[model samples]
Target: MMKKLENFAIQDFQNDLINWYRNEKRDLPWRKNQDPYKIWVSEVMLQQTRVDTVIPYFNEFTTKFPTIQALANADEEEVLKAWEGLGYYSRVRNLHSAVKEVNECYGGIVPNDPNEISKLKGVGPYTKGAILSIAYNIPEPAVDGNVMRVMSRILSIWDDIAKVKTRNLFEEIIREIISQEYPSDFNQALMELGAIICTPTSPSCLLCPVREHCAAFHEGVQTELPVKSKKKKPVPLQMAAAVLYDENGQLYIHKRPPTGLLANLWEFPNCELKQELNKTHTEQLALFLKEEYDIEAALQPLIGTIQHIFSHRIWNLSIYFGEIKSMESEKLVQVDEETIKQYAFPVSHQKIYKMYKGEI
Candidate 1:
């Protein structure tokens, strides 16, 4: 059972938070309108990404696909192109699939009901709550990391915020106290407070609007209330990428498989270096070319190495410039810069391309 909040009035807390929000909230682009489609896009983009980075992406995305129907009508490649720099490709794919469903089934209107909206692809509890409360003014708790941080400090909860059960506990607490008349601003205020004031380290407790109700602040433990378990280290991987050039001066590129990491994006011909291939990078490239593509190639000196760090993997990529001597298969295509520009390349491959063009 959850403990009841004490020593402070809920009504006063709500008023203070709402008043501070009205005066101090950042003028984000998504706040300019209450359109559900725009709001949903912003919420998805803001996941695992900073607000400043999301601003340009949100603006470009809205400009291209202003309406749900427009997004549904766009090709998957076009949508991926628009989301090129955004690391999480699956979000864009799910958003694209969800918009298509909304366009066909709901006449391009984002459903207001929580259950109906949650049924869409990639629409989790938090996303559903955000869309309903922020766009439609529904009284639902949007418990993201920020909201959990703020609530954990206010109530002085000691549970591990990283655990699933702890998140559910926070949700229940929020549902009980969330503002009914102004759910949008109320939830945004909680998130904004966590982002700027009740931060993970060295929180600004003195400047807090609802400091009187902050149990952790009174106990002088605001920074330590929201406990989270440590994450495991990312696995390191070594890779070799070959920038193959044909006699016609066209670069060889291939599309990734339809699913898994970096699905459907184009990339330079590369292979992970296994323990068995203990040869030098150039020797490995020669072997990979002969075995995978049945092509005879001569690898030039190592051009450079590009380091790309994903959430769970760190790729140390060694790039090599090579010329195709003879071809025995048709697995890879040779394309010029103009043709390659039409396809979305993963950021790692993009870095190699920039190096080839002397841009980096």
Candidate 2:
């Protein structure tokens, strides 16, 4: 049985890595402060998101919900609106719930304990350890994908890093190698090294400061150490939506189903296309209302077609403002402060709403 590589000059590694980071580290908004709440939010938002992609959203979110208490008290729709277009709606939901827990249990301050933080919804071993170490300076090594790739190459671990047991083994290796003097810096250094230097596809060993210590580099397998399992293709779906409006200038949007894809977010009266778009999309949309909601309206095309891709499905939408005959909105879901504040929406609608919010 092969034991893990438990010995390395962790301090030396940390020092050299931080020195490199001083010059090469990307200037991220979250790195500016050591606030645990902000770090927690950034980490959660950054799950499977690129740093460049998350920057603007992170800035907007931090500006809107400045504190954990704000996030806790905010309507779910507001959270979802903020999170619109960002896939993994469940993360937003859990982040909201976890903020409530922070307000209730931790008294508005995100706790410094890893285990306590881990108990919150959506937080795992990585997030818990990251927040504890980075924001609170706890001695936990937060091993994420970047850290894992770096580790697999450094130690020449040829096992598939995709499996939970294999990942757990790597975490154990990190646990043993983490330094006492500067565990947070060491942990971040490993992650940064992995991200910028020891990338999965083609590593730049010449740029790596620790190439001498990297076993995979010595064995000419730096690019092949951290093997991953294959990913399945995302299922495609035929989804449609309409932006209904009347003479009063109020748009007639429906509330989504209370759970699942875009739960509780507002959308134009949308329908599932069981058959392909056989006729004019606008004509078919009017017929859909006549059949399902028992109402008719003069629908005109205004909002352009927009497509939003989630992790699993794709939404191909065609929006039009329908000028319906004078009738009260008995069928439309009444959006209220209580009901509107949960569930993320597609980014297109959110963008339109933001532009037209003052008018609406």
Provide the TM-score for each candidate, comma-separated.
0.96, 0.83
lDDT of 1 by residue, 66-172 (tens): 99989999999899999998878889999999999999999889999988999999888899999999999999989999998898888878889899999899888
Global lDDT of model 1: 0.90
lDDT of 2 at 202: 84
- The segments of candidate 2 whose C-alpha lies over 4 angstroms from its true place after superposition are 6-15, 276-287, 300-305, 318-321, 326-344, 348-360
Reference-based lDDT, each prediction: 0.90, 0.76
lDDT of 2 by residue, 160-248 (tens): 77788887887788777776767767777787787788887888999998877788888998867788888666666555566555555
RMSD of 1: 1.4
What does the lDDT come to for candidate 2?
0.76
Model 1: CA > 4 A from native:
6-8
Clashing pairs in 2: 75-341, 76-341, 76-342, 77-341, 77-342
